[model samples]
Target: MKKPGRLLGSVSAAAFAILASSPALASGTLAGSTITNTVTVNYQVGSVAQTATSASNSFKVDRKVNVTVAETGSATTQVSPGQTAAVTTFTVTNLSNAALDFALVAAQQSGGTAAHSGTDNFDVTNVKIYVDTNNNGSYDPGTDLEVSYLDEVAADASKTVFVVADIPLSLSTGSVAGVTLTATGREGGTAGSQGAALVETTGADSANTVDTVFADGAGSSDSARDAAYSAKDDYTVLAAALTIVKSSKVISDPLNGTTNPKAIPGATIEYCISVANAAGGAGASNVAISDPLPVTVTYDSGYGIFLNGTVTSGVCNADGAAGGSYSSGTVSGTLSSVAAGATKTMRFRAVIN
Candidate 1:
């Protein structure tokens, strides 16, 4: 569904709160009111604008900007990673008068670590920011990493940062991310010209925001972030957990004679791994299960089944060990969600030779 972009129509005084014992910071103390304005969302095709760019003239109001980072079919076309998806966009717009100067020191869009070229838009050369991985949003040196400045956003002009988040790579997504950006302005030497805003972002969407944009479609995500956070914020939140889980190991029969549950020769063993969302955090997708076929059976050359030529439910029974580079039977199963404490099991059997 294609919908018209929103102007963010309203602003709350609470959105900003600025104070100045010294009257040299900004337009106003930013203490009482708020400013909300229009911003053109740079989505691919089906993308929807969550809110208009909001800010404040009073330094006391402590202006804020909320943005949502997501994948679009293309920066030029669709909003989400449609059946066939392509581009990635990071949108930001300044609601203030003078042009906005976003100091980008370090940043990446799709992978684990970004290849920030010597290029202009992608390179976050040399600035610093306080990252609140804990979600406190406040900079805590003990808990946060002093990440360098990343890509910048234009003043009042909503802009998008493009990247490739798709899979299959010799080079990693570096660090998959819904990069949350922050810092006060610094293009100028004036007092509050580089002022800070109370910024918020949408959670990182799996593909697009349509399903995640509304409350009706959140499913497990509703509970994970399950908050009013935006796409960018969600990405930051889940990114932490995803980082931890990505480090988990997949089981495989080691050729080494060392461990317990030693590979038995000529014996069939049913392997069942039930993935449970042990903690109520987030769910993982595109999980690949791998294990070395037991040494007991040999894999059939033609069919890649067990040497004994027996097959069961998602299982291969034969002389325990399989042939031809450790055979694998299937990669089909959908665990819609492994909710907190909920488990999804994948079973594969190996026969002993």
Candidate 2:
């Protein structure tokens, strides 16, 4: 007896070829989706055609969880001792396809070779983290939500958080502190309990089955699908120091003349004012120095006050000719900027009344 001429094999091969060539039968779907497939068989028996349909095969796409973090504000902020620095904002986004919660933690690192890197010799006090509830991209006290960890964030959604800290009074000038914020995915419920998985069904009344198609290569459940991410910011302390000193010397006396001048009536006394800035401190801006003539003395209109021994019209020129000016009983000057370890002097003469 002759064999069946491989009719069944030929039919199976033809069906597979048709399935492979048809674009409508492609095999990929988005995460958290379901794929259903069915096939029909057709054959001819002695010129009589017959058809039969096969059962449907369905597949569920597993969930994929991922997160990203970024610092939203200026990369670096300047602050003074005992001052509150500008808030550093961070945005955490859930790149996953399912809703999930995240646990947030902050850390401070000191001294590295990179730019803005220095030993954080001091600690910033009263540091607090808050959520930007109003979505204004800023940290507003008494208005924005404050939470220890991030609450439920929808897939492809983001949440903004803030880090507000104070520069301790004891922190030295030029000291720097680096802050890093980290976000980790939180597994739901008690130990060994798989958190809510991405459901294949939509709306209410959906089943709780896991979508194995998108499952992680490790085969872990949805709760273990997500991963962590982090970002960083820096703070530098600004310390400005200013000091002033006054000195006086007798220029001349009507009775004793210029040599061995006395403080008697009709004697001329010279006054000097010295201003200095501490070393390694931030430059002082718009500095104004003023001195009032002693009540016991009179202003000598003919005498010129010298600024760093120049600009002799009662105005000091240490910063520039326009740096110093004087009126009837008082002398004042504005210095555009005074750098660290720099000093300027002002001198004027007054005669005893």
TM-scores for all candidates: the values are 0.26, 0.60
Tens digit per residue, CA lDDT, model 1, 1-353: 22212443333333333322335532222212333323333434458545544322211123232222232222122111111122233333333333334443223344333222211122111223333346443334456444332233433444433332232222112222333332233332233344343233355422122221211112211222221121231111121022211111223344532333445553334444445444534445554445454444544333342221222452333332242234364322333344443444544445446
Tell me model 2's lDDT, rounded to 2 decimals: 0.64
Q: Among all windows of ten consecutive residues in candidate 2, which has the lowest summed lDDT?
A: 213-222
Model 2, range 25-97, lDDT digits (tens) per residue?
1122234555444445676889888775344444444455567777776546678777874567789887665
lDDT of each: 0.32, 0.64
TM-score of 2: 0.60
Q: Where is model 1 poorest over a 10-residue stretch in terms of lDDT?
A: 239-248
